[model samples]
Target chain A: MLEDGNLVFAACIILMTAATYFTRAGGLFIISKITPPPRISAFLNHVPASILVAIIVPSLAGKGPAEFISAAITAAAAVFTRNLILSLLTGLICISTLRAFVF
Target chain B: MKTSTNKSPGTRVVFSGKGIAEGFLKCIPLGIGVFAYGIVFGVLAVQAGMTPLQAQIMSLTVFAGASQLMALELWADHLPVLALTATVFAVNLRHLLMGAAMRDWLVRLPPSKTYFSLFFLTDESWALSVREMASGRKDAGFFLGSGLCIYVFWNSATGLGATMSSLVDRYFRDPSVLGLDFAFTAVFLSLLIFFWKGKSQLPVWLIAGIVAWLFFLVLPGKWYIILGGLAGGIVGALRDA
Candidate 1:
């Protein structure tokens, strides 16, 4: 159970790579068939944004109020700027700076 | 010669050098983030003990950011191989939906283009293609062009990031803790903001997001994305009704 132990690490990478390929390949294969219907198409259209927010929200869980504030500030900057790199840079600067001062 | 004898300005614009250049230019902002993050993944994979060749191949082949990161994290956690595999599969399941969405757009493209476009099927490229498709650009070349540009940047950056990682031991020492991961989250949010056009869709997305978080909190594995996606999807569909 040693973290970064060589055997464990390699196995993790290989397994993760295999599993991810399986899913992505599944999509590539399925795209060749089964044209999505209107209702289904509409439903799938909503899936990406939904999946995105779902991914982001859980990431913010368990943070202190300060980190949350930092994230919120970052999110606002991101929204206003519509610049992904800028938003992330601002968030990083804000969080690291806050950690330096607050902790 | 009759067919090529005359073409309208509009047709020329559609297939113009300007159109292709414009597509590549549009992808620049998104490309920088993708390349930087790709480097982080490459470095992390190497740090996790894969040889450089192994790490590079994984990035080249798999090409999904979150899955690579999650795998490295799980490896660090010492999770069993089966569990790690399962997590990777679960996290990437959403791409199936993404792929299916692109099918209609790709069905008519030549087989080579269809296959090549798959390489650029990350979240950003998908979002760009989806938005273009939504705007009624049924010509698959737009997607093909956009996907090709992003693909080039992604793979090249992966190589550069991996190479860069080897030079600066300190830089390669830790994952760019907040660097690429934050970009991952930021890219996802940007997609959400773009897709949410008005206040009408706002509440539904918010609820879906909350539900995703709750599931992620409670669920044992990566299935939370699927759960959150379904819950949010159903809510949004109902609200649209």
Candidate 2:
């Protein structure tokens, strides 16, 4: 399939693959070459949770009541059970049920 | 590249079959969640006019779900090569920070080991590895092993979704109806519990969430995520500094 008609598409894939691999390896590649300043390292430390929150907030804000309630339920389930899968299951079930019957 | 395999602040990096196996086994549950997304992506790719083979190739090579889905949005008769690749870079820019966080956890290993492990890095794998390392288990192999688990489920589900797109489309017209749309949100909401550093970090999250919401309203594409995440990171870093 990639042989005859898909050369441009294939090139796009290659470019994407290269660009992605760069991002994945670039941080270590740069850090290995030179030491990052303390503040920069601090920034990295905060980015993980910050990014997670950033991703979640916009998504959660865009949703409605069932979504908000389910998220709260999921967070509570996770804290109480200390189980990721169980909490996710609870959230999924809660949302499905609410969307079906309540909402 | 000045890395000392001889010394670290704490736990020694452990690379072994047992560690890898432990990582692999621990990730099975998360892998099931990943499979759901994979099937969703596969079904969408088919609808977007991609052949299953093409979708699998994209999945195998690019290996990032968000970027792949974005590519589909930008897909056309003649692909917008620059736009497609640029968006890929933008969406994955978070990885630069994530990979750097691995610096200490990975510095002790050889370049071969480091790069090999880094290639498989994804958000889920990185999360598991971070927790494992934080808990003082030194198995560097956990990153690779968990990533492999995700890789298996994600790719296999892609194939299944691509092949069975019709059945999925007919049955599940709206992923929201099944709450499949909330899978990642659910995953991240729960992760926030573990990442919660207490009231001290509340301001950072509050700022991040507010900034993200504002930008989501104003900007297009995935820029809000990056901008909002950076805003949180900057505020948190300033407080720490």
Candidate 3:
């Protein structure tokens, strides 16, 4: 009976929301039963950065020279400034400028 | 350094307007990054066949940047429900650990308030709240406030970006021409640097990046993300042992 694309999309969104909430709340429940070890916490601390690198590396690896240059510029900006907004702006501006004129 | 006025000498947790305001103020700088990322997601969502309303709803409900972007990337006419759900679950599994790490702090709140606040637990809010807790502040309002700021900025920016997508399309024709497609990668990289702890994390980053790159060459879908993250986490755990 659920044949409409709109209905399906709404359902998908609800499902995603439910699934995400489960992860957040469920973690608290699980933690209450047993404390995560120090090693696990250390690993968890590293996971976020690792996941970000994982998400980014594939896209960066297959991209063009402009993408490469812009990524480096962004990385350098992040390293030197330690500011998220500035680094993002650096990437956005650098890539757009390179594409507009150089590429 | 403003202290919460609602706290008594023995009180372990305080939720107050002043703490909320401070948390919101602390989040403003990072909120810009969230807004920029949300705008890109909005533009991409419309391009991927979502109506502006649908995109807005996703932003309001889901709110996690990486998972939402991944959803847009996986969006299609038929709506591959199972695949999309699996990808989202995989990508967001990290929230489990993030929430777990905050259990000591969140456990002090009433269950309703605790879970309600968890709905807005993004990487940015989590990082900020963790730092706040480390500084010996136990105000739950700080967490709620930080999450609220991000939620507002993310949803509004997404709505604006979705509204402006048509204009952007007419002018730029292709998002990649302006390198907007790379925005996700750039944003993630910047965040990774922000969360960088020490030299000990270098191996984890290298291992994850290499695994992800290898999987990108062989895999058809986005399993590489989950695989690479798992590989890095395993190595990190082992290294600690």
Candidate 4:
């Protein structure tokens, strides 16, 4: 509750830990008791990928048009190649080189 | 093979330990970047009038990089304590679902153990755990193995990073020269590729990208994350439906 630097850190630890626990606990508690509907299960299955796109796309939005276009290219390469590391490295090289040279 | 067959409860302990070791080892490059990033957080904590011990404790306890950064930003802006508190809570709201998913594994542990382990949960840990859990990992010990590895290294690295930043900077000079800044986007893109599944999901992904860009332009604050996620989820579901 206090704003002292140390206290703030302590508070964050306690608050974040508690919040994370409650969310997980809610799912574990409820899901264990009942069989989730097929629809719900399907939704849960997609959640992680949805969340990933959720987090990534916004950050990419802040870039320039060329960066955006190249990133799209990079994403396409990733899908086509199905190589995680390669795709990411390609995106990094694309964006960083663009940043270093173009802008 | 014989080592893998050692049928002792200590086997669980040993496996957990080995898993932790491997996890830590795998995390080295990523960990180094995290350490560099931690320095920035540490400096901000110290600047905000926190003692070194307090700064270490933040890394020890809270341990979420984004949440910590947001909290520091809010503090610097002189936001009310309540507002700062609320902002921290809101920023970390996703972890609640993460925690809930891990609850069954948690239920097996003693109250004290579960209580303590919960303290170390973060986005990275949760991401790692969810990956393991979704693949139907039955052993609570596997998570303990992975999660503990993450917890120890993260805190130690942050504490050490914060403690050494001044001296490290003087010796190393221009830490940004290391190119650690782009690691997150790189990591995300890597994970994204790994999770893409197949061509069926491509349109959904594209729609998600477009929605996120539109939301970022139209919305303020971090709503882009939420809006983009919901928008993407709906599109994904509708296509499958």
lDDT of each: 0.64, 0.82, 0.77, 0.58
Q: A1-103, model 1: which lDDT tens digit per residue?
A: 4445666656656776666656644665665666655566666667766777777788777767656766777778767987655776777677666665774
Instruction: Show what share of the native A-B interface contacts model 3 retains.
Output: 0.69
Cα lDDT of model 3 by residue, A1-103, tens digit: 4359878988898888888788767877787666668887666656656667777899888678889999999988988898766887899899999888897
Task: Rank all candidate structures by their lDDT, best first, as comma-separated numbers.
Answer: 2, 3, 1, 4
Residue B158, candidate 1: C-alpha displacement in angstroms: 4.6
- Give per-residue CA lDDT, model 2, range B80-188, as digits (tens): 8999999999988878877877776677677887888887888777777776775577768787788888888889989999999999877855556678778778888
lDDT (Cα, tens digit) per residue for candidate 3, span B1-241 = 3233222345477667777777788777567667777877888899999889999998888777888888887798889887777777877876776676576467767776778888888877766676567557878778878888889889988998899997764554444655567766676777677666678789999998999889879975566766677778879889888
Which candidate number has the best DockQ? 2
Residue-by-residue lDDT tens digits, candidate 4, A1-103: 3556546555555765555446434444565456666655555555556656766777665657645755676778776876544665676676667666776
Local lDDT at A91 for model 1: 74
Instruction: Output the TM-score of candidate 3.
Output: 0.71
* Model 2 steric clash pairs: none
| Complex DockQ per candidate | 0.38, 0.71, 0.52, 0.36
List, residue by residue over B154-237, the lDDT tens digit for candidate 4. Answer: 677567656775765465533334434554555556556667557887776777677767877886445555555566666766
- Which pairs clash in the backbone of model 1? none
Q: Write the per-residue lDDT of candidate 1 for residues B3-99, one digit (tens) a residue.
A: 1111223322123344445556666667776767677766766677656666676676666777777767755444477876777678777766666
Q: Candidate 4: global Cα-lDDT?
A: 0.58
> What does the lDDT come to for candidate 3?
0.77
Error of 4 at A99 (Å): 4.6
